[model samples]
Target: MNSVMITGCSSGFGLETARFFFEKGWHVIATMRKPDNSLFPTSDRLSILELDVTDQNSIDRAVREAGPIDVLINNAGIGYMSPFENTSDEIVHKLFDTNTFGTFNMVRAVVPQMRGRKAGTIINLSSSTTLKPLTFMSTYTASKAAVTAYTECLALELAPLGIRTVLIIPGLSPSTSFGKNAGDKISKSGEPADEYKALMEKVQSEFQREMLVQELTKPEDVVNAIWQAVTDSNCPVCLPAGPDAVALSQ
Candidate 1:
């Protein structure tokens, strides 16, 4: 049976992907920052481990523990909300650390093993926002854009080695905690926003309308894309998941 490793498996796309792969007979190594704090229901084929993607030692340990993985799903990410002028260096760096740098660290840790096997796939969880930018989310959009560009480069570079890199761009999924968590994080950041509060709130509301109220997509949408990326022999290099994604791709 094929075995896969997915980061940020505690929730959202990561958790759904792990469960989907497990049900499909793939041994899934689900790595979260806190294994014990997993919110997803447990399973026998799912092996949970603590893996902070920003830390090299954590990546090394998880890589070693996962053994031979046929696919690596880099799904860990954090979000931020602020206008370009209001975003602090600290918040911007935090978003990059988890979304961009974390993804790079995971790729670096797994690429060597994939190279040895000469057969593996890397699926990056990118954002549909890369197609269109919204206000107050410049930093978050930029981070996903970075991932999209990096994955495009990796697809070509790793192809000769018999490895594939696929970009799984997800639109908005309402059944996930992504929006709630993002709102909470921004609320806690305590950024000074007297005039921008209305604008930020408007942006946040629109994000919710698209992602949650409309139910534009579900976790299963992403799981299906991920399955196709890892198992389908003729899958495209970049697959967008969800209805919004399909519309955007057009």
Candidate 2:
């Protein structure tokens, strides 16, 4: 059976995707920062491993343990929201470490095997906020925008090697850790500056309102998009997931 290794399987898209593929009879290597078998249904086809995508040693070890695989899903990322001025260098670095470099490092770890075998699929999860910049989310948007741009370029580079690179743009969803993490980051970063105060408050209000009123990108939408990316030769390189994401793409 074909095997797939996915990062960030603790929750949201990664977790659901892992479950979906395993139910489809694919060997699933579901990885999180800390392994917890209880989060998954018991199955001989499932392999849960601890992985911290920001660390090369952790990635190398996970890749080694995962062995050869037909698919790699780069879904491990963190979200933060703050005015650009309020976003410290350290916070920006952390964002890039987990949201950007983490993805790049994971690709580096798994690409060698995929390149040699000349077959594999690389699916990355990027945010739909990148399509339309948010008032207080410039930093977060930039990080995810980098992923979208990188995947587009990587697709062309990998096609000749018989490997496909696909980008999945997902909009806001309650199931993901984004809201919690972003709120935590902003709390730690302290409140917005006086100049940005009014704008930030208005943005936050609208954001909460949107959550209540808008149809978000569901975990299932992302899982289905990933399935098509891996199984359909004619699927687009960039597939937007959810109602908001699809609408933004067009």
The sequence of per-residue lDDT tens digits that candidate 1 reaches over residues 35-154 is: 853454566666888998878999999899888888999998876666777777777777888889999999998999889989999999888888767777789999999999999999
What's the lDDT of the predicted structure labeled candidate 1?
A: 0.83
State every prediction's TM-score relative to the real structure: 0.91, 0.95
Off by over 4 Å in 2: 179-187
Separately for all candidates shown, the number of backbone clashes (residues 3 or more apart, or on different chains) is 0, 0
* Model 2 deviation from the true structure expressed as Cα RMSD, one decimal place: 1.7
Highest-TM-score candidate: 2
Clashing pairs in 1: none
After superposing candidate 1 on the true structure, give the runs of residues whose Cα lies further than 4 Å from its correct spot: 37-44, 179-187, 211-215
lDDT at 31, model 1: 90
> lDDT of model 1 at residue 11?
79
